[model samples]
Target: AVNLAIAFAMQGHENKVGLLDADLHGPCVPTMLGMQDQKLKVGPIGAFPALGPLGVKVVSMAFVLAGKEVPVVWRGPLKMRAIEQFLSEIAWGELDFLLIDLPPGTGDEPLSVLKLLPEMDGVIIVTIPSEVSQNVVGKAITFAKQLNVPVIGIVENMSGFVCPDCGKETHIFMKGGGKKIAQEYSVPFLGSIPLDPRVCEASDMGHPFIMEYSDSPASKAFMIIVKKIKAFISERQS
Candidate 1:
């Protein structure tokens, strides 16, 4: 989800984007964006986010940890305080959009960020096409609605897999769960992203899949969803 958001923000030269990795327990933005070894600089005001590709500023717990194996074993209050600091102390300058990547489920981290950014545009729920994912994602939607945060839409990741040899599309996790959930909840079904192995390869290499494999099915689906997100934002503003 974070990678896709970065790709969407980098689509246009005028788009200034920032990404906050609020998944305190398992922050992956630093590693995925290839800034794991980079540390945040303490300036006059606060910590500055590391510069990423396309000039996307990013902040993650991975940047603060002494080592990759370091663990964050704190209570709810500590976690909430950390999130607050990330929002208030991080030097996130003017941005067209700031995407906060929350840990999955309606947990303390996600709730804290939502409360801190009440005026946030909305949330783009990402889930795989499965009964379990659909069930858990339902709670996510409810959480956002209860907090008065609009749900932008749902993006079904790993919706299906395309065979490399036969060129056949396989329903690896079964299909249509995302759209079904959207319909049942009366929310928008943005689009579906097929399960492409190249996505994993790109992540392991610290490269954005959309940039490396723009011709892949998953990348194509991602751009389609990105368009829907922009349209949704425009409609809301208008």
Candidate 2:
């Protein structure tokens, strides 16, 4: 999701993007973006998101936590309130796209965000190429449909692993599950991102992999997915 946000921001022309880390239990977006220690600036109006790479505005609970080791152990109601504040209290300013990264599941965090943003463009479900992961995609699609939220599509991450030396692709988690499920549910298959070691390194260093390794297969896949997402949104608007 962080990579996708970066992809949209790095699209050359002036495109304003804001990423809300709605995954309350594990707000790793800040850490992955290399701003875990950064805090949101508050003024009389509201709080301002931290400026991330490629000028993407980012908001996450990790910024307000006492430390990296701190955990958000709150009930559902508390979490719902926090999300409400995140949406209403943050001065997101004007944005071309505001991507909310929800935790995996049809749980409270996603439910709250969906209810709050009834006019949301859509929800993009990310999954790995495994039966276990694909099974959850069905539930997610149903969840969005039940709530009257559009399912933008499905993104298959860690689809396959390419050996650095041999350049051979290995189906570590079994391939084509994403497209299969997308076909099963009649949703668009945005693209598949192959597993790359550099992605992990970039994440740890808080770098946007799509920018740093734009030529890599995974990065290329991200670009394709971003284009599809943009087209989807454009079509809906038209």
Candidate 3:
């Protein structure tokens, strides 16, 4: 996966796109984008790669501490600096959308983002379609609401699976869990994605779902969600 989900994001628009991996604890975008071997240089000017796409840029802790399994193990201040470096020092280059993959939960990352960009467009929450997953996301939603950050919508991943033999729908994780949360929050329910083996297969092969299996239901779901995201954001900007 070339992270074209980030690429598809800029489709038909002449705007800038920034894919920020705020998941300090488990920053996987580097591995996901196949840029894990690349090193990032931090200079007095700022921290950024010397080469990449024009409008599309990525920054993540995975880039900073590449090939290392050491935990960040920092307090709020260190996390704050990392977030600051990502936003202020990095050459974001006039982004229209900064898709931040925040570390799960209502911890330092989300708080730092809220503090850094008080007028942020909003957050797109991701969760598996399960009661336990929804419960945890609900807590995050509560924190966001308390801090006054509107949730653009919820992206339901791993909603259900299809039986290859009989071609019947299986409620692997049960269904409608994401809609329940969206209804509770009064935010738009973007869409649901199935547990396609191709999704995991593509990721293992270093290809994102949108790239490998664009015709898959999961990819179709993402396309719809992307449109909803664009519309929701446009409304917010207006």
Candidate 4:
């Protein structure tokens, strides 16, 4: 989701974007952006975010860890503090959009980010087209509403898989769960992303799938979602 947002923002040269990997327990932005070995540099004021493809500024715990194998065994308070610092201390300069990739579920990290960035534009909830995911995502929506944080939309990821050999589409996790949730919750249904092997392969190779596989169905779906997000933002601003 973060990568897709960055790629969409990078489509035009006018927008300045940044991604904050607030999922400290399993920070993957650095790895996904191919900066696993890199470290965040401390400037005079605060730590500097690493530059990524299309000039997207990125900050993640993966950059701070000595290695990928090193585990983040911090407690709740510690995790909250780290999240606070990531928001307050990172040198995120003049960003038009800053996408915070919160850890899954309504957990400590998500709460900390909401508390810290109270004026967040909104959240884009990502879920699979499954009943279990639908139930859990409902809790997320309630949590956001309780905090008075708007939900921009919901994205149903891995909605289906298309066979490369025969070009047949399979509803791997079952379909319409995302839109059903959106309708029940009264939030906008952004779009559904079909499962594509290239998405996984791109992540493994430290590349943005939207950029590398622009012609794929998954990428096309992602772009449609991005357009909806932009429209939401514009509507809010207007």
Candidate 5:
């Protein structure tokens, strides 16, 4: 959800936007956002102060835990409370969006996020091209609908492989599962992102592709996706 948050922020929404990484088991947003070093100071009333009122804010169970590398061994309620701390405790003044990135499945993390924010504006489902991913997301959509949350759109990440020298492309992750799913559910197909080597490089160097290489094709596509999100938000908010 860091991508979504940063993208929204880049689209000129200067207001505060918080990202809660409910994936306690696999928290990557902290490292991805280059906010790994700061100690997550959770207040007695659950207020985390570093994330300012109008800047981009992020919180995760991994950040709040003893150590990011240490295992978060806990049951359902325990996990739920941690999610609560990340949500209720954070001092997100006002937000254009609170992009909560749940782990890529219908597990405790996602369950906790849904239960925590039942009135979420919308969920932008991210997935690669595969039956496994699509099948699981069908369940996710059904569950989201069950909780009365809308499926805003589907983002097909790593949808194609970009050639290094010639600029050719290949749908290495199976096929157009995103389009099929979008068609099936009557949701918008936001955009497709080709797998670029630079994206991995940026991740390794601790920056997201959009910020690192804003002019790359993948970055441009990311910007377009952000535009789509902004349009969606504008239309919905109005």
Candidate 6:
């Protein structure tokens, strides 16, 4: 989600973007974007999100927590209220796109987001090239459809691994699961992101892989996925 947000933000300044880290249980967006020490600036009107790379406004529970070690152990009502405040109270300010990073499940947080923001454009379900992960894709699509929300597409992450020395790509997790699942469920397969060690390293160091390693195979795949998403939105609008 952080990579996609930064990628879209990289499309020059005209397209403004905001990232809402709605994964209440695990708010990693701030840590991934190197905003661990930042906090939301609350004024009389509302709270202002922290400015991330390429001018992407960001809001996460990580920003309000006492520390990274602190846990958010709240009930459903509390969580719903917090998410509601995050949506309506934050001063996002003229966003061309607001991407909500949801937890991997059809749970309270995801349900709350969909229920609150009925106008959400769609959801891009990300899955790894594994049967277990692919199983979740169907559930996610059904969840969205049941809520009358559109399933934008599916993105396959860590699809392959390329040996740096030999330059040969290996399907470490098994090949073509993403495309196969997309076909099975009749949804668009955006692209496959090769497993790059640098992607993990960059994330740990609060850097977006696309910006840090644009020439890498994984980064190139991300660019392609972003373009496909824009195309999907364009087609819908037209």
- Predicted structure with the largest TM-score when compared to the true one: 2
lDDT tens string, model 2, 1-238? 8999999987752348999999988888987889988998999999999999878999999878888788899988999999999999999988999999999999999999999999999999999998988779999999999999988899998889878899888999898889999999999999999999999999999888888999999999998999999999999999
Which pairs, if any, clash in model 2?
none
Instruction: Score every model by TM-score.
Output: 0.96, 0.97, 0.89, 0.96, 0.91, 0.96
Candidate 5 lDDT by residue in tens digits, 114-213: 8778877778888888887888878878878888877888998887887888877877887889889989988888988778888777666657667767
Find the 10 residues in a row with the least total lDDT in model 1: 6-15
The digit string of per-residue lDDT tens for model 3 on 1-238 reads 1333444543653336678788888877766655676677777778774233333467878787736687888888899888888888886666676777787788898899988988888887888888889778889788878888888888788888898789998888888989999998787788898888877676666555575666777877877788888888789889
Tens-place lDDT per residue, model 4, 101-200, is: 9888999999988887888889999999989888799999999999888999999998998888998889989999999999999999999988988888
Model 6 misplaced stretches (Cα beyond 4 Å): 13-15
Which 10 consecutive residues of model 3 have the lowest summed lDDT? 1-10
lDDT of 1 at 233: 89
RMSD of each: 1.3, 1.1, 2.5, 1.3, 2.2, 1.2
lDDT of 6 by residue, 124-217 (tens): 9998898877778889999998999888899999898889899898888888888999999899999998899998899899998889999888
lDDT at position 24, candidate 5: 78
Those runs of model 2 whose alpha carbons end farther than 4 Å from true positions after fitting are: 12-15
Q: List the residue pairs that clash in candidate 5.
A: 46-89
Q: Between which residue pairs do clashes occur in model 1?
A: none
Q: What's model 2's overall lDDT?
A: 0.91
RMSD of 2: 1.1
Q: lDDT of candidate 6 vs native?
A: 0.89
Steric overlap count per candidate = 0, 0, 3, 0, 1, 0
- Candidate 2 matches the true fold with a TM-score of 0.97
lDDT of each: 0.85, 0.91, 0.75, 0.85, 0.76, 0.89
User: Distance from true position, residue 127, model 5, in Å?
Assistant: 1.2
lDDT of 3: 0.75
Query: In model 6, which range of ten residues has the least summed lDDT?
Result: 6-15
Best by lDDT: 2
